[model samples]
Target: MIDIKNLHKSYHMGKNSLHVLKGINFSVSEGEMVSIMGSSGSGKSTLLNILGILDEADEGTYTLDGTLIKNLNEKVAARYRNQFLGFIFQSFNLINYKSALDNVSMPLYYQGVKRNVRTEKAMHYLEKVGLADWASHLPNELSGGQKQRVAIARALASDPKLLLADEPTGALDTKTSYEVMELIQGINDEGKTILIVTHEDDIAHMTKRIVNLKDGLIIDDSKVTQVRAKAENYV
Candidate 1:
């Protein structure tokens, strides 16, 4: 339920222009899982930021579930992002001093959800991520996997139509990574659209389709099945 066409993005660096995305065009349907693979400066993350509405592109047309997002102001964009997008970052992005449940509930709270209703929904997602027992624990008290799971729970608390993840398992061990992926996979299986930007080859393979980027352009798109894990060309 996402559509993009001829996307171009650039930045100003000391009066010179640095292109981040030359032109990106892609589509992702509802209930499908997709991954983006690319080297550093290849525009994968930039593209993700654009799709996630964290940043605006210089020129492009993006329709997220039929909402054209070309010229929306920051206020509008922020409101839409909160309502429609769920973001999972590589750094977990959890508040260090807040309990896991509180962190997950914070988003909804900011959105004006009442305490009782949001807390119940937040706890439900935490239970789904196997973090029910650790709801009262702070980030420092939880392991990396636990922290990421908390982040996952937070992302799911909004019941967002789209889940946008950037290197979701990058900070965890292999076993933990697999565990988190399994959690994300479960969400995807339940009819949520998932778009993950990861450099891991196996992670890309686990998705139904992979989009490869190079030099700020989409170079390849293909359907593939899961294979053995190997080092990805993240360069």
Candidate 2:
């Protein structure tokens, strides 16, 4: 679903260039769950942002589902991102004033979906994530785990082919993080590719494959372990 080659990104820090990513390459197949694991300053987030198309790469080629990313104009990139990808962030990124239902409906609203259709679809996803009862509540009213669940629901409401998550479990406790992982696994089982960037080992273990990044390059790309349903742990 995603093909990346020789990706490079740099930031200016007081006349010095901070080269975060240098020649990273990888491909994600449909329905695959992958993890990019690294410590701070390892460029994992830069890679994720590039993959998510939230940021552009300074040097490299990225093709999503087939179309070359660099070739796209801003408007086309936005539409492609909205249509094919969903994002979950560490901050939850929920509108402070919007109810859970409204937050989940935001993506569809941007897609030009009508109020009624988007509302129904958003509720369907919220129910799938076990947040049907919390729809009327605001983000501040929900627990950390509940807020993350709502974010996941919102990400899935668009029926995206890929989900990009950056440190999704950072704000939650261990137990809550595990529960969030379970929810992510269930979503992957339904055939959406998932790519998550996290520093937590347990969270990395939840993915089918782990790619270790260091100094802006992939040093290890291995199947650490197969992912299992939370009901029956992996053998």
Candidate 3:
């Protein structure tokens, strides 16, 4: 569902330029769950940003779900992002005052979906993430794991073609992280394409394949026996 070839990206720091991604090539197919693994300065974040269309690559070709992604105007990029990609961040990114249900409904609202329909869809996703009972709670009222579940529900509410998670379990405890991964695993089993950007080995192992990045390039790419996270063990 995603294709990238020889991607290159750099940032200028006064007189010097910091090369973030150099000659990087990556691809993820439909119905696949893949993890991009890397250390702090490994360029995983830069790659994710380019994949999410939040940032432009200085050089490279990216095609998502049959659409060529390059040099789009902000308006068009936003439209494509809403129509095709769902993002989950380490920080929940929920509006502090908004309840879980409201946060989940935000994307649909941006898509100009009707209020009633969006609300119904939001509730359905909240249920999918096992957060329907917590729907009325605000982010502050929920635990880290609950907040992430809400974030996951929000990402899924729109039914986007690709789900992009950036350090999804970064702020959670080990048990909570496993619980969250289990939820993610269940979603993948239902046949959605997912790409997770993570630095944790256990987190990466949860996915079907791992692509290791270093020095701004992919150093290793291989499939692994997926470690299924048992949410029940944590519960």
Candidate 4:
């Protein structure tokens, strides 16, 4: 559902320009689970930002589900982001004062969904992430894993076409990380397209495909033997 060709990005600091992405090209089909891997200074984050429409590429083209993503006005960009992309960050990004249910429903609220419908959909996704019983808890009241689960529920509340996860398990322990990956795998199995940016090899292996980046270039892009995440096996 994502197509990119000759994508280039750079940042200017004083007289020098730092190139972040250089002539990148790749395509991710619907229902594919892909992970982006790179060491420090790689263009993975920049690529993710461009894919999420959080940043613009200096050159080349990015077409998300057939729409050319280039120089979108803020209103149109926000609309496309809300309608087509769902984001999961290493930092859960939940509201501290908002309960899990409220956090999950916030996106729907912004979309102008009715209060009842928003609550209904939020709870449905919370249940899907196995957080139905913890809906009343605030982010601070939950553990790291629980908070991420709530965040996942929030991401899914919009039912967006693509999910972008940036180091989704970075803040969790190994067991918790595997648990979360298991949940993510199940989501992908249901036909949701997911693109994850992570530095961890084991985590990348959990995905169906891995794209390796170095010095702003995609050095390797290949399908992998997907490793099923079983939380119990980690310990």
Best TM-score goes to which candidate? 4
Compute the lDDT of residue 55 as modeled in candidate 1: 87
Candidate 4, position 214, lDDT: 99
lDDT of 3 by residue, 1-235 (tens): 9999999999998999999999998889999999999888999988999999999899889999999998899999999999999999999899999999999999999999999999999999999988899889999999999999999999998899999999999999889999999999999999999999998999999999999999898999999999999756764
Model 4 C-alpha lDDT per residue in residues 139-226, reported as the tens digit of each score: 9999999999999999999999999999999999999999999999999999999999999999999999999999999999999999
TM-score of each: 0.94, 0.94, 0.97, 0.99
Model 4 is weakest, by summed lDDT over 10 consecutive residues, at 226-235
> With candidate 4 superimposed using the best TM-score fit, by how many Å does residue 9's alpha carbon deviate from the native?
0.5
lDDT, model 2, position 159: 88
Q: Which candidate do you rate higher for TM-score, 2 or 3?
A: 3
Question: lDDT of all predictions, in order shown?
Answer: 0.89, 0.89, 0.94, 0.96
Per-residue lDDT for 186 in model 3? 93
Angstrom error at residue 57, model 1: 1.1
lDDT (Cα, tens digit) per residue for candidate 2, span 93-207:
9998999999999999999999999999999999999999989999999999899999999999898988999899999877788788999998998888999999988788889
For residues 25-116, write the lDDT of model 1, one tens digit per residue: 89999998999999998998789888988888899899999999878889898889988999999999999989999999987987999999
RMSD of each: 3.7, 2.5, 1.1, 0.7
Alpha-carbon deviation at 57 in model 4, angstroms: 0.4
Q: Model 3: which ten-residue window has the lowest total lDDT?
A: 226-235
Clashing pairs in model 2, backbone N/Cα/C closer than 3 A: none
